[model samples]
Target: MNKSVLDASALLAYLNEEPGAEAVEKSLAAGSAIGTVNWAEVLSKAMEAGIAPETLAAELEKRGILGNTLDVLPLTIEDSMEIARLRPLTRP
Candidate 1:
């Protein structure tokens, strides 16, 4: 299966067990990645939910979602431009 790139919302939905989580889980299980910016967004949302960063990291690690399932990709200049170009069409 092709590796999928997960946005902040999709990861958040999976983390919170909300709708569409199953799809996110399937993607993760099949190998997926999340860009650094989106990972930051996930951290921000977790903070807003009163979860400490360490706790969140630990929880994800325990669930095998960190290094094993989801790979976090560092943002590059070209990636930034691409994200900007796709923002309008992708933003919820």
Candidate 2:
């Protein structure tokens, strides 16, 4: 099965009982799992929206999604420097 990377938007949609929840649910049903680096961001949004952490954890478990599988891809020092170098030209 192919792995998909899910950003905050997609995760939030599933957690919030939104329109795209079905699609996300389908993906999981088909064994397509998601990976993310920004877990704290996602968790914070869920908490702010009144989703109990236990509920979220249970849902993820039911969907066969494990928290430990999330990939934390941090920007390297060189990458950060490169972005900083290009920031001025790219800034709106």
Candidate 3:
């Protein structure tokens, strides 16, 4: 709750109008964040659902839901380093 790092999935859910879209909308209004990486994930899902990228981007921009507008954070060194370290584990 303190970090607000848990809403990207909800954001995607909201875009898809899934079960928790309302909560995601509420979270967005209350100041939640979306990671840059998660933006790709959201876009990917939107594409898979037949949403055109340009249109989707516009929708997100209009809603002021683009990561930068709401709080799009880049990976910190520690996070990237850990992901690098975990790459070997991912191989298997």
Candidate 4:
């Protein structure tokens, strides 16, 4: 089974139909997930684009974005801690 841990950029590409969207779409079709924080990032970007978060969320849900193609998963404690630990490795 093809799978991937999608981040905000990948999701945004798919949503915006940008280049490389097909790769994201493929992962989505095979089922995929995003960290809750990444999920928030996607929603935040949508909101910045004038979409009401609730409205977009509702539509996505209605369209089965959740439970079908993508799963918005809560970050586990280990995941959060790892992110914190890796913070210093990332650019500011």
Q: List RMSD in Å for every model shown.
A: 2.5, 4.7, 4.4, 2.7
Q: Look at candidate 3 and tell me the lDDT of residue 1.
A: 28
Off by over 4 Å in 2: 52-55, 67-92
Which is the winner by lDDT between candidate 2 and candidate 4? 4
**Model 1 stretches with alpha carbons more than 4 Å out:** 86-92
Tell me the tens digit of each residue's lDDT in model 2 across 26-82.
654554434334555777777897887677767776655754443334556886689
Using TM-score as the measure, what is the rank order of every candidate, best first?
1, 4, 3, 2
lDDT of 2: 0.63
Runs of candidate 3 with Cα error greater than 4 angstroms are 1-3, 67-69, 81-92
lDDT of 3 by residue, 1-92 (tens): 22456445777778768898897777666666666788678778778989977788888778776544456667788988997999999786
Q: Mind sharing the TM-score for model 1?
A: 0.87
For candidate 4, give the lDDT. 0.86
Better of 1 and 2 by lDDT: 1
The number of the candidate with the highest TM-score is 1
The window of 10 residues in a row where model 4 has the poorest summed lDDT is 60-69
What lDDT is obtained when candidate 3 is compared to the true structure? Answer: 0.71
Across 35-82, the per-residue lDDT of candidate 4 in tens digits comes to: 889989988999999998888778777877766778888998998899
TM-score of each: 0.87, 0.52, 0.67, 0.81
